[model samples]
Target: MRVLHIDTGLEWRGGQRQALTLHKGLLSHNIESLFLGNQAGELHQLCKNNHEEKYAGFAFNGELSLTTHHEIQNIVKEFKPTIIHCHDSHSAKLGSRFHKSCTIFHTRRVSYPIKFLSRYFKYKNIDAHVCVSEDIRNYMKQHFSNTFTIHSCVDIKRFDRVVNKTIFDKNGDINIVYVGAFSNQKGVDVLIKAFSNLAKKYNNIVLHLIGNGELLQPMKTLAKALEIDHNIVFYGARKDVEDFYLNSDYVVCPSVSGEGSSGVIKEGMAAGKIVITSDLTANKELIDDGINGVMFKTGDSNALTMSLTKVINKEIVIDHQKIKEKVSLFDCSNTIEQYITLYKKISNK
Candidate 1:
């Protein structure tokens, strides 16, 4: 089956990664797939370097302009894909314009509820609505009829091949890593506060803040104000995140808002590291409390501090093997199989 995946995001976030991974997975299975994204986007550059033959570019100005509409029409006519998968809001808007001629499937990666009529209409035009988490599906199901929940998957082999390099001091400093956008929704402030408290108690603790966003400088400022800037290292956005996952003692996802099954959680589990995440509906679905990973109260700095202390003091034991086994279900192969099934179902109709 031929598929066309479109994403208008300028940055390479979890959703963009998923789209690229899915395109690669589809190609491996001998299913023709192409990725169309912003010409100046990070995803476009990465895809051009890796999957150069299958990558397509368009000049997107964030909104649905006449140029974007013309480009979509040209691509649809040229590719003639059996399925057109929209990976973001902007792409979904463009996909909706061609819903009558082709099967349009939108993957909702965020858990935020759709309250606007225009947004609801855009979704209504989609042939199938695939949600990355149950929390997202629950929100979309209320308005759309063909909503399906498919959790995001990671390329586990990438994590497995990471060379374990020593990132921390040899004096046994507990290195904690947080890999996500530096935004209020991701609860960067809460993580900083929690890390500040932990750093005051233990001098051997360090927090590595990876990824970048509009709130990056603000988060760094907060670390300085807390007087824990020395304990936190801001890596901005790095391509070699597997190294951070491999060397860290723990991975933390301190999101205040609900996530659509965070890729950070899956990546940590795939690396066999203990992931400490906020206790939300979607997070609870992946983590079984103290079993595979641990969860703290959402947006609560004290709760995060306590969870961190548990790991530092050896109060919590992590079963690396069990974490790997649990994370296997979300492998990219399994996600591809499900998507193939969905594609067949839609194509038959």
Candidate 2:
């Protein structure tokens, strides 16, 4: 089967990563697939020779230009895809205009602004909507009324377990790491505050932040004001995050806003590193609460601090490999096969 995947993005993140992984998996399954996205996008360069691109903007603003729609139709005609999978609402709307021959599926990867009109409009275009987590699915169903939940996945092999069981040497400091963009939604400030408290107790604890964002300077200032600046290491925009996961004792994700499914937590689990995340729907989906990983109340620095302390004191027995294994059920191979099944069913209609 021939498939066309569309992403309305520029900067690479979890959603884009999933799309790329799915593309690669489809290729392995002997399915011909084509990827379309911004020409300058990170995923654009990863596409095969059959892939096409439409660089709408650096950011998707929900606007659909006629020229863009015309280009999509041209690509659709040339590729003759059996199915068109739109990765976001922006691309879904554009694909809706030419939705005749191909079966189209839209993947709702986040709990967003939740605009009433747009939700209704989104319900109108795509044949089926796939959400990355049950929490995201529940949110969409409440607002939009129809959506399917397909848990987000990771490349298990890429996040292979670290062989060296040697204790991570942070010079007697316990290393706490956070991997993601420096955004307010990620609650970097909350993490810094909580870590500051942990620092007051365990002077040998360090916080390592990987990735860059708009909130970097403010978070750094917050760390400085909290007097834990010396205890924190900000490795901005790291490409090699696996090494960070391997060398760290634990990972923290204190998100205050929308999170479909944290790829960071999965990667950490895959790397056999303990994780402490917020009690958000997305995070809860993966953590079995004191089983695989620990979850603290979202936005509660005290709760986050307590959870971190528990993890450090050996009160929590986190089976990082077991936690990692749960995500395999949502692996790219299985997810793509689900899409193929859906496409066949829809096309038969």
Best by TM-score: 1
lDDT of 1 by residue, 102-213 (tens): 8899999988877587565667688999998888888887787899988899888988684758654331368899899987789999999999899879877888988999
Q: Write the per-residue lDDT of candidate 2 for residues 1-349, one digit (tens) a residue.
A: 7878888776778889898777777777778888777666765654534353322222333456666676777888888887788887777887666567777788888877667777667547577778888888887777655477777787767766554444333433688889999987899988998988999899678888888989999998999898888888888876677778877889898899888888887887877777889998778888888888889999999999999988888887777567767767766667778876766776677
User: lDDT for each of the candidates?
Assistant: 0.87, 0.78
Compute each candidate's TM-score over C-alphas: 0.95, 0.90
Stretches of model 2 off by over 4 angstroms after superposition: 45-62, 143-146, 161-172
Q: Estimate the overall C-alpha local distance difference test score of candidate 1.
A: 0.87
Tell me the deviation in Å of residue 154 in model 1: 1.1
What TM-score would candidate 1 get against the native?
0.95
Candidate 1 colliding pairs, count: 0
